[model samples]
Target: MNKTFYSALNKSTVVLLFLAMTVSGILKAQKLPLPPRANDAISGSTFKNQIDTLSVEDSENQIYQEILNGNIPTFLRDLVPISFSKTIKDSAYVVTYFVLPDYLAVGSDTDYFLMPMTPILAQKIAKAIDFTLPTKQMVDQIWSNASVKLAPSPIPPSAQMTTIPVMWEHNTRLKGKRKETLKQAPLGALVAGHKKDVIISNKIYEKSSKPVVIYGWHYQNGTPIQPVYAGHSETYADYSHGIRLVQDSVLVNNKVHLISKVLQDIQKSSLFSGEGVIEKPFYPVDKIE
Candidate 1:
């Protein structure tokens, strides 16, 4: 073979090998395990049985029906039987703890009236205990029973800000000099990138404010598609341009920290999807009766 031809062939072989390795690494990465599910050992039968026992009384049946219809008035779902390995006196309260996926903590502890629990309060208890909810239906039940009432005092104007709308789209990259549209990317590739971007954007927003509500809804061109996940939201207050909130589907326990980290990552990468909002401040006098 001519020396020039031999050299060209060697370069071509090296390029092909590099491409093969690169492709292999991407495939491996794409094979990452699915996100973990909430782990509650109580069987569905056992949960039903317990509910049945509690519903023996007529009054209890009313409560059970209320819960089933998503009308549990208290934030704490009906308490499952809890056993403490060791009891402590002067504890002020004894409550069952529920751990949410992504590490969120929910407590069934309530005041004397047993009003529904607030997500903010549940977050406080989750800092200490890792408990699991037996079922998602329980969460829905609690939310339904819980009523939203006017604040005891008017909320400060600064605190009453409305959230900005957020949107998510699949990430697309060109392949082999072909400019591929986002719609053309493999589903897995698009999802992975979108998830990472959400994580990144969330961290950037957390530096300023904690998001009170975080839920996932799909969108195309600012229209709802379908809801995917429900979780907490976080915000960044310090940005000079109006307030920005970054939201994501995070494990309950991992919410606060994960949000902060994701936002910071976005700042570092300077990759923002333009999906977020600044809340409008509410005046306490106007809000309160």
Candidate 2:
């Protein structure tokens, strides 16, 4: 009787210890805590009001500040993985990358502003979040794989295209279209179109001045309106421009490689860059301010 009671007690204690460890491990696997700057950003409506009174430079600065404070929609936080298979030199390679379901926006999921920013400001935010901008090839791939392909809705060409009010108007229009799209697609579905992507390219490495490479405002038919163009200054931004955040770490053939390194690799660049050997894949933010 004494031996049986001791055995039962030992089994009970071991079971409880195992359960406790499992729960502790699960908790540790959860997402890490947000930065201290999170939860201090203002709402979308308030940002709009503030933009009306701010200059273009000031407004762009504020946009970066809000992003730094984590003033983005909850949906944008969850990244969607995009995978594609390619064959090179008789070897089949699979490349998988993660990207935000939608372009970077400010405010809540219910009411957010699709913030358009200069390449300088955009690069700043990308660095803060440990993300990088897509290459033209990645932009094409993303548009092709998008679950929600919105038609390119271009506001007429004008000087005000880069102004704050125009940015607000464009955001409102996109929200309406997104609402209609959500009826057919899930909330966090990968979305494209409605804005041209500010991408990275070897063009930024051109002699002379730094330029921002803009590409991709695909139609429902998967045709992009804007080609890979680098005519605009790196600091140039308009209501039509968007920042699509790509996770820096990408999986190539099931092995992890940093995106910047992949772009620089001669053999692996084909997986992401159509132009071959991107060399310099990120924008320079030092002097744009």
Candidate 3:
């Protein structure tokens, strides 16, 4: 080959190699692993057969017939899953009595029903049931009780500014109407159920130019005497420019008060630990969505 041609080919090869490396790096950054599959144990053919059997049984139900005939809202019909509990065969018949746009009924022992919806749909169904049942007062009572334990103490007049990260308190207890306490030294607050929603709504109200970090404590179950609190923190990125919340889960409670107001009161100390600017630079508007 001519020397000039050879040299040109070598140069081209180097450019190609660099392009390949850049492309590989981009792919690695973008790829996200999928969640585990639910039906991993079943063979594809066996699963198909099970679904066919369930479909046949579903077709025989009078209520299912009504749904197919369009008596119910299509969204409900499409969203509700068919669930069968072998322990309560008669309960299946009762589900049909509600005349809900979507429900399940079992006729055979081998039948299995799986809801074709996501967790969000389950929440919607729960909300719908709450609305029909009118249980807002009960929910409010629980939240109010929870809030009493979580409310923050008044910031001292002397303290001009503070910077705190989002924090959480796990395994806390709801004590008397006025207060809640932790079992150990690092006591945390009992967060209100609506606090997360309130924080997000406030960010929009303020037209915040910077990110808003919200610290919350999550309680799963158990009596107030020995409750569990998991420190949960989320950051809402700049919303004024249209970016939404960018959540980050920090394990450390750098500032104890950031997690709970009650904890701060007990210790008589600053809410955050290592900090630069504590108070939000701008106060959010009182109104929220």
Candidates' lDDT values, in order? 0.23, 0.81, 0.23
User: What is the number of backbone collisions in each predicted candidate, taken in the order shown?
Assistant: 35, 0, 15
Candidate of highest lDDT: 2
Q: What's the candidate order when arranged by decreasing lDDT?
A: 2, 3, 1
Weakest 10 consecutive residues, lDDT, candidate 1? Answer: 165-174
Candidate closer to the true structure by TM-score (higher is better), 1 or 2: 2
How close to the true structure is residue 192 of candidate 1, measured as C-alpha lDDT?
Answer: 10
lDDT of 1 at 220: 22
lDDT, candidate 1, 209-256, per-residue tens: 434322221122222121222233331211001101112211221112
Q: Write the per-residue lDDT of candidate 3 for residues 142-234, one digit (tens) a residue.
A: 334341234322222222211111110111111121232234211112223312211222222233342232322223331122121112212
Per-model TM-score versus the true fold: 0.21, 0.85, 0.17
Error of 1 at 269 (Å): 6.9
Per-residue lDDT for 61 in model 2? 83
In candidate 2, stretches whose alpha carbon ends up further than 4 angstroms from where it belongs are 1-40
In model 2, state the lDDT of residue 282. 85
Task: Give the number of colliding residue pairs in candidate 3.
Answer: 15
